[model samples]
Target: MDFRPVLHILMRIVLITAVSLLMCVPVALIYHEPVSPFLYTSLIATILAACAYGGRGKQELTTFKRREAYLSVTLSWLIVSLIGALPYLFSGAIPGITDAFFESVSGFTTTGSSILTDIESLPKSVLFWRSMTHWVGGLGIIVLVVIIMPSLNIGSYNLFTLESSFQEKIHPKIRSVGRRLLYIYLSLTFIETFFLLLGGMNLFESLCHSFGTVATGGFSPKNTSIGDYSPYIQYVITIFMLLAGTNFVVHYYAVKGQFRKIKQNEELRFYYKVTFVAGIAITAILFFQTDRSLETAFRESFFQVASIITCTGFATADYLLWPSVGWVIIFFLMFFGGSTGSTAGGIKMARHLVALKNVKHHFRILNAPNAIIPLRINSKPVSAQDNNGILTFILWYFMLFLGGSLLMAWLGSDVPTSLSSVATAMGGIGPGLGSVGPASNFAHLSDSSKYVLCGMMLLGRLEIYTMVMLFNPWFWKN
Candidate 1:
């Protein structure tokens, strides 16, 4: 694999992260917090970017191939997470290396799991930079899906990428698609910020929340997450989280006034079906079992459902304290993720839909001795390669969940904490069950456990195979 293009892009990514760091400077100045943390981190990122560029490949980035693409994506997230930790370290917000990396990985993966027990105690600038990690990571996920992953063929995502309509709606060039998605992403953030402002949130909190909402990242600047906010604010966030969880392609079609295409999206349909069913079920649970009003029950249920389904991880209420059935509903939804081609993580609805179709096909085959059946999604027949890829991905997802849970338990966490923490980490959803639930942070977990969860976050956010490929011996072989 040619290292030049990958080197070149990594340099640019580091520079982009450096600029993101500098973005916190203004916030620091405005809030009268020390700016050294961001400035110093930005300086370090600049030097690393320079070093990466120093080894520039003469070939253009477009020349990078499959192996390089895999290396590039894996290294991009890992390196950014590595550099992202500098802020926490410099600011002394999180002082330990393991904890800092854990927080950084959580941020860059947009996992929203945090070790910070008192979020309100951090400086506004550090919090802004923290939220910026989500915005950047979210952008990274969007770019990878729209412009890169389609070509990589991971998880048989070609189902979405192979569609000709997508090419017509968005430009074919990588840079063009990235720019277009950036506009859509920024628009969502700004629009949500405006709405939150209208709901009486301050500009700082609004931007932070907007960053989290649009990214589907749940790292709020508040200790209570979204629980302290008004219903109007929660409702707006719930709606946007739903939007964020849907495939960005659907949003692109909606932007192009192509509502017909959006409506025809099978994965979007599946996503909505899961979300509403889960939401209504939780709403009923909350309403009958508690003293909350119908509207409050509806708001909290939908918000929590959207949060978990989308992997947004925000909380308007702690469902762990609710009826057992309420939290149980959430537990299952962790495995049923949002649409693919979106920043939201988990196994993804695209794979789940395919898995379902494949299962139904098998039942039919069981009734017929010899039958040729094709698995289909979005009215297009799925290739056998894609079928195997999707199912294998699902199987591996569960296997890793089991392995990580056991590892966590072995590391001394109780069964509930171990299972849900691993599940939530792998799902990129914050607030797991047990000790890591919405009301608690991961601070209590051992350093070994935090590191394990960090690894889970990367594998989950990258859709597993991308990162796991690096561990395979042949990937490094000539």
Candidate 2:
């Protein structure tokens, strides 16, 4: 391991985080929240960054190799989450060190799981930091650092790929692609905030919810989430969640007047089609079986379906109390996440599409002994390497999910609670069924179980392989 490159990256992350906190401090003060500790935390971060980076060693920064890229991505997230926890700890809102770390991880991972029973009682500044973590985390910490500091442009592309979900390379130049992504991200957040404010939400609430929506983090300002808000506000959030879960590369293409490319993207078409069909099915079930009006049922069904399908986890109503089939529908949807290159996490839709195509091809080859078939997506034949990687990733993902569920069950959780918690945590979806359902928080879990779920969340957020590679002995070999 090259200590200099690792130290250099860590210093840069600390400096970036400190600056981010300083920018947020004024916002906290305006809301009458205490800023003294936040100020001190920022100072500490800056000083630490300086100490780490200001060495007189005659070492040039090494170009990050693939292994270095994996290490840097993992270390950056772990270190930044530790630093990000400072505000929560210093602010006294989440005094326990474990809880603070958990909140920070949840925020930065865009997992949206909260241990706090009362989210509304937290101060505005702390809340801002909470939502800010989601925003920063949504695009990815390493990607954000790469865009802001162009000096690291060359080595950072590998780190970006390691941090990002989609295996698809969108652009030849990483910097240009990063800039376009940031632009699209900012525009979506701004538009969503405006719509929320127009729909009767206050400025602060609108901004916070907008951060959550665009990030697809689902950290609602209100304790009841979107349920306490106007129908218009709920619908606005629903629309943005759908948008947020889409591939940003497609959005970039759309912005650049490539309408045909946008329309022909197979993943986007499949994503919307699944969402529409699921929405109709769930809405019909809720309307016919429950005591809700057709409009009310459709609204609730659409919101919940979108939330779970995108892995956003925002709740306007408790779908756990719905019929048995409704619960099963949600459970299945948890596995099919948003598109690749989007903020939402899980096994991405593109990977599933590839896997399904390969499955069909396998059967066809079984029947025709002399036939040669190629798996294709978006009219291009899938490479053998890409197909192998996707298949391996999916297999390992399920194995880990099953292992996590069994561990949780052994730690005193029921079967459904264990299953959903495992799925939700591994999928980066916040709420689960039974006790860890949409309406309930994860406060009731045993401390060990919470830690387990936290690990699962990190694994899910980092796209499994990134975290799993750290455990491989070959990763550390010199």
Candidate 3:
């Protein structure tokens, strides 16, 4: 396989990351903090990217083979995270490479997990940069490459497909789809920020939380997270988080006055059903079991459920403090994440929906030996390839969850901590139960455990196969 195209794409991604890093400089300057971190990293990234390109462009490679796509996409994220760690290291925000890499991976993966114990103590610029990682990493580094850097247009389609969620393209032109995705993303950020500011948040807090919410990323500027904010602010965040967790393709259709398509989407319908049911169940439990007022219980219940299911990881309460039933409900939601083609990360509701339907069809076929039954989704018959792919993905996901939990337990974590942390890390959902719950952080874990969790985060974000396929001899041979 040709390596130049991959290197060229990597350099462009690094350059974009460098530009994003520079955005934090103004925040640093405004807060009267050290700007050297941003300045130095940006300079180095720019130089490296410039040298990689050597001021030349190759217009011939717009589309590439599947193997090249996998390699480029994986390297893009790994390289971006490597560079993303530079600022944290330079600023002394995270004192070691492992911790910095962990935080950087969590940030880029939109996993709200953090190693920082005292989040409120970080400099304003550093905190802003952290949230910015969520925003940049939210829409995806590959999507940004396809949109902003025209020189890499040769293999842009491959990169776009590798990065996008599992949904049909919204536009005929891949570039148009990328552009629309960016527009919807930006519009949502602005709207959320505006409402948050109106709800008594200052500009910085508003922008930071807005970035976190719209990306379905759970990073917050305050130590208490959304709990520290007003009910109004929390409500606004909850609504936006729900929106972010829905498929962006659905949002694209809604923007063009195509409500019918949105309504007909099977994964979306299942997503809403799951969210409402989970929210209501938790709300009833909180209201009946706890002394929280009706409205308070309902709001907090809905907020936490949305946070977990969307894989956003934001917390409005210490859910561990809730009764046993609440814990069970939360853990159950861990397996069913937001819809596919959404910012939220988990197993994805689409795969679950399809797998369940396929199982039902299997029973029907067994009952009627010669029946010509077919699995269908949203009135369309599912392909055998898709059916097999979803089934395999689900199997691998559970196997990993089991293995990861066992590994965490062996590392000395408590049973609850081990199980939930494994679930959270693999699902890209921040905050697990027991020790790593919402009120806690991951700082106490050993370096070895942190490294393992980092690997899990990458696997979760890439949906397991892209990274796992790298280890297969046939994958490389192809």
Candidate 4:
């Protein structure tokens, strides 16, 4: 391992954490909450950062290679999670280290899964930090760091590409692209928060929900999530959630006043179509099976469907308590995540699109053996490498999904709960079916199972390849 690259990234991350903690201190003080521990933690982080980077001047820092990029990305997350856990731990709200780390990881991963049973009871400052973690993490730490650190500009692209989702590349200039993405992200959050406030939520609630929605993290201040809000609030969130799950590049085009690009983008079109069809199917099921009014049923049905499908995992109602068919619909939607390059996680819509096209192409080739067939997406011929990468990613993802489920089952969860929990965690979707459903938290799971799910969340968030490659002996041999 090249310790220099690792140390360099670690120092950068620590510096970021220290700054974050320092920023949070005044908020804590404003709320009249204890701030000593937060300040102490910041000092510790600052000292550690200084020690790591002080000896070697900035001139000694070199460009990171691909392998180093992977290591840096993975290590940065781990370090951030570990350090991020300090506020929770020092605040004495969550005593257990593992639970604190879990919450921290959930926040940074934007998975929005929380072990905390009572969210509103926490201090406002702590809640702000929690929500802020989602906001910062939504775009990504590396991307954030890359934008600020001018010296690392040469190789920042490789790190950004490796860290982001399959379809999230903004432009050739890393800093410029990062800044544009950040602006778009912040604008969306501000707009959503404003709308939520107008829809009757308070500023705090609106801010928290905005953080969750924009990040697609789903860490609501209220335990009932969007279910506690009015129809207007839910509707506002639904639109934003849909936006959050889309490729930001599409949003960029829209922002640049390119209305035709938005209309012409095949992924965006398919995304809305899928949400519409799924919403209709789910709403119909809820109406027929449950006693809810059409308006209510449609609202709840579409909200939960959009939430889960986008991997946002926010809930208007506990779908687990719904009829069997409703449960099954949600189960299937767990695999159909939002568009690539979005904050949402899961097997992305683009991959599913490519996979479906590949299936049709195979059938065509079988029928006419002599025909030249190439898989196409958006009227463009798909490259063999991209196709293989998608296929391999899906295969590995499912294999791990099944394997994780069985392993969790062995650790004492039932088959259904275990399988769904693994799928949800691995997909970076917060809720699952059976016992581990939206109404329940992961606090009941065995320590082993929690650790397993944590690994799964990391694997899912990193898009499988970067994490998997680190395990390959070849990654270390050179």
Best by TM-score: 1
Model 3 TM-score relative to the real fold: 0.93
lDDT for predicted candidate 2 compared with the true structure: 0.80
Predicted model with the maximum lDDT:
1
TM-score of each: 0.97, 0.92, 0.93, 0.91
Off by over 4 Å in 3: 55-61, 141-172
Score candidate 2 by TM-score against the native. 0.92
Candidate order by lDDT, decreasing, is: 1, 3, 2, 4
lDDT of 4: 0.78
Clashing pairs in 2: none
lDDT of 1: 0.89
Q: Quote the lDDT for 359 in model 3.
A: 78
The TM-score between candidate 4 and the true structure equals 0.91
Better of 1 and 4 by lDDT: 1
Error of 1 at 130 (Å): 0.7
lDDT of 4 by residue, 46-86 (tens): 88898878643442234566667677778777777888888
Q: What is the lDDT of residue 296 in candidate 2?
A: 94
CA lDDT, every prediction?
0.89, 0.80, 0.81, 0.78
lDDT of 1 by residue, 138-197 (tens): 999998877677765666776764366565544347677777788999999999999999
Q: List the RMSD of every prediction in angstroms.
A: 1.5, 3.9, 3.8, 3.9
